[model samples]
Target: MSKSYKKHPYLKESSQHTKYGKKFANRKVRKSEETLQHKDYKKQYCSWEISEYKFYMSEQEVINEFFASRNEEYHWMKKFKTLKEALTWWKKTYLRK
Candidate 1:
């Protein structure tokens, strides 16, 4: 019938997707990567633990006290790559008695 021509016609290809740079965001467009690799290798992966105290002490206060004066509450944290280093710092900072 007359409706057959409007439904499906014998036509050529509509369009072609000839593109490049598909994974642009996942790639790093940098000239030098030698120094970057060395820096990454020398980086320290430290794990920090923050403990909240009941009351703030004289010496054990937040460094930015003036910035947030209303919130007097503070917690101390230490970062160390290994358990031994973390225990050492904890003893020196907390268990000094």
Candidate 2:
């Protein structure tokens, strides 16, 4: 396939990328196991969005803002006094290997 600079047009001028802005698999320039081009081909989408990158919550903010609409029936959140505490518990439970 012709890997022209149409996809990645802004590769910084350096040895890391080609003169035409095409990136190559290398020991230094770590390759993304899941590149955007591969994802577009699989989904057959004209455009794509990484929905996981979107953040509705502010850093160190209260959890109340998120659950304002959700009533007390969401008793699971009440266990933590603050958002940090909830995140800590969640990380410990879900992320720990």
Q: What are the per-model numbers of colliding residue pairs?
A: 0, 0
- Tens digits of per-residue lDDT for model 1, 13-35: 22235212322312332332544
Among these predictions, the greatest lDDT belongs to: 2
Candidate 2 Cα RMSD (Å): 17.4
Q: How do the residues 1-97 of candidate 2 rate in per-residue lDDT, one tens digit apiece?
A: 6422222221122443333322222211344354555344434322233122222222233355435524665665676766677766544433332
Among all candidates shown, the one with the greatest TM-score: 2
As a TM-score, model 1 comes out at 0.20
lDDT, model 1, position 20: 27
**Alpha-carbon lDDT, every model:** 0.33, 0.40
Candidate 1 error regions (>4 Å):
1-78
Report clash pairs, candidate 2. none
- Model 2, residue 83: displacement in angstroms? 0.1
